[model samples]
Target: MARLLSELISFLEALPEPRIVMDADYRIVAANAAYMREFGAAGGLVGRRCYEVSHHFSVPCDQAGESCPLKQSLESGTPQRVLHLHHTPRGEEHVAVDTTPIRNEAGEITYFVETMSVVRHSSSRPAAQGLVGRAPAFIRMLEKVMRVAHSGAAVLLLGETGTGKELVAHAIHEASSREKGPFVPVDCAGMTETLFESELFGYEKGAFTGAAHRKLGLVEAAAGGTLFLDEIGELPLSQQVKLLRLLETGTYRRVGGLDCLSADFRLVCATHQDLRAMVAEGRFRRDLYFRINSFPIHTPALHERKEDIPLLASSLLERVDRRPGRRLSPAALNWLQGRRFDGNIRELRNLIERASLLADGDTVDLVHVQEMAEDLPLDLSASAGDAAGEFRVSGVQPLAELELAYLRWARRQQPDDTGELARALGVSPRTLYRKLRAAGA
Candidate 1:
């Protein structure tokens, strides 16, 4: 088997496009010559994990927060496709990826084939490369972000604490024209007035008691780029006036400095708090709120997009565990679909992380998931994955009687749909009806 798998290395190396074969453990088992030219050193790829060479991350692409087509294909037992922004030698480039699963003789997925094509269009770059969502609200939000990103507008992100606002902020920056510029993020929460001034505007030498030399502030660091002020509602009234001055004038003076310097940077702000209410309560300055709120983008909370949970969970698990063949069983998925993820994406990551550790083998089952759930305070139940046996009889019955009994059981679960019952038993609806009628069931 080892020699057989090694033989694939030569065949893969001949492909025109960059292609790699990852084993169930996500180790790069083989890479073609194009792949070597594209992203490798031409040797020692066989032992390295795919994420290390491609993403420079310690974890899998899904866990490192990129939607992974490799993992997606493994689970579906079919080809999967995704658009990604990969860090190439030249810079970030848009790549369309197609993944196909390779199954062993016993029909178990053992490896994946990943082929990547560079996408040329700018508008089609997925706003957030790894952020997974299919819900209507999520799609709407993504569309809005994509549209707003290209323009040099001040974007205000609003969402619950765990709703992934920073990811949205970065997406807007990535999709915008200034993607090459540095994206400097500032957390405004609990920053003292002195700290705010020093951080946003650099202090000249001898300007302050501890200032031994001139320091470059975040605003200057983000020149010709983006300056993200997260939790802007936390800015004190005194600091708000100073930020307003900078935004309005497009200039700022260093802390205790003599000259005014230009701050050529795009502004983006985000917070879970209601800035409008803060303004109404006289906590947040009205003018600053208006300056940053030119284009408001709201990230929907997890519950609002329940339909996306399945993909989200799959993506998160793939991110957490990269053991090539690890999978969330159909039963486990049925259980996860019914969860109310209060912590949103972050909380889901925790659940999967813990449950993955509890689960053994490639398939994470109902028992493993339920065990994790019982230990946590999360509200969940076993009703989804639990299966009540089809056999109501105490002893073995004839094959005919067994078929009729199982068909009857399938009917109770599917209820009144001949096609659904037939699907459950892997039989044609006509055959299902004929058997039931023959058995007087």
Candidate 2:
């Protein structure tokens, strides 16, 4: 028996899934290599209770009621299965947990075995395709994605257009155990109302016009992986009902096929529009909105988090211009900082790409930036409300007073760094500091 158990442990260790063994008392007895690699530094897990290591809970695993598979198997002498959300020792994020039981002599369960699958964002292995920026907002969103990636719950990614909601969804898939599976993306806006059902659930050969062949839907193609529905707000009301039904039962029938097929895939939806408002306007189903919003993440807009502009600009420039020593000049960066980017990160990236092409040398100067800016429609509406009322550069508002107001606004937008402001107003750092002091900022 001892020899057999030793061999089992070795095999479990070699398995790609994270595996851990817990004794009858729910105390962790052994953990495999994959488990340690997934959780990071599982040394302290030994002798600790399963709940302690898996959930950071101080109590017994059964404290959450009799639904615990480990306790159920120990009591009933029957194999059990359960899903759990577990945090790793290094506090990386939550993982999808699966638990089973190992029996000994007399058919009594002696140890509980747990398996974990780490979720990932996308199947793309390119290191350069990682989430951009180290800003607090960006990091916080990444952490949220990691936490919810493993669950069966639907995720709603809310952000302005071009905030990379789709990228975040891919990151969630990549971080999950489903990394080996396919990641399929569906653009809801592109699907006509009449074709929505067939496109999403797929159709059988001769199901409808142009249904030339049997096909696997995006959901089926993403089995054991992730299905990303972009612009979900654009989904027609009729399709919304079908989607909601599938989400509820995990069952669907291919067009022209009577047999129902079930698919197991994680769902991640993204949209630039306000889903809540759409629901109120009768354009979207309220129930569907609630269903997908189970785990919601709001991506920060570029203008709302201007402090990250420099990093974003630099990253965009590197992506567009791979030339050696390519860099943005201080003057050009200042102009970018002062101007409100109405189109958000996408617009900024486009501008940088154009500026890089127009730049004569490796250094992108203000002239190149200005040339690009000239082509862009003036964003007067962006600053109208804040700079228009009682804060204008005319009348009783002296140059110093105007500077103070602008400084205050600038500080609010880009705190912790005045470099952008200095460049925007075309002043030396020392001069900007003296002016700020004079204005009592």
Best by TM-score: 2
Q: Could you give candidate 2's per-residue lDDT for residues 1-441 as a string of tens digits?
A: 576568778878778888888777888777898878768554567888887766667776568542477767777766665444456554444344556777776776667787776434321111234556545466556557766866767899999998878778888787777888988999999677657777778889998888889987777888889999999998889889999999989899988999989989988999999999999999999999998889999888776666667767777787787574588888777667656576888889899899899987879988988788743322222243343334333233235435556665555454556787688768888887886665445
Question: Which lDDT values do the candidates have, in the order given?
Answer: 0.76, 0.73
lDDT of 1 by residue, 1-441 (tens): 565466666677667998988887888888787977876553467888877766668988889767787888877889987665565665555565778887766788878889876543231222223566656577667756776878999999998888878878887888789999998999999999999999989899999899999998899999989899998888899999999999999999888788889989888899999989999999998888899999999899887777677767777777786464577888777666655576788887788788888877988787777677632222222122225633444343346545555554555566667888788778899998897775455
Clashes of each: 6, 18
Per-prediction TM-score, please?
Answer: 0.57, 0.60
State the TM-score for model 2.
Answer: 0.60
The local lDDT score (0 to 100) that residue 83 gets in candidate 1 is 61
Query: Which lDDT value does model 1 have at 360?
Result: 70
After superposition, the stretches of candidate 1 with alpha carbons farther than 4 Å from their true spots are 1-129, 322-325, 374-441
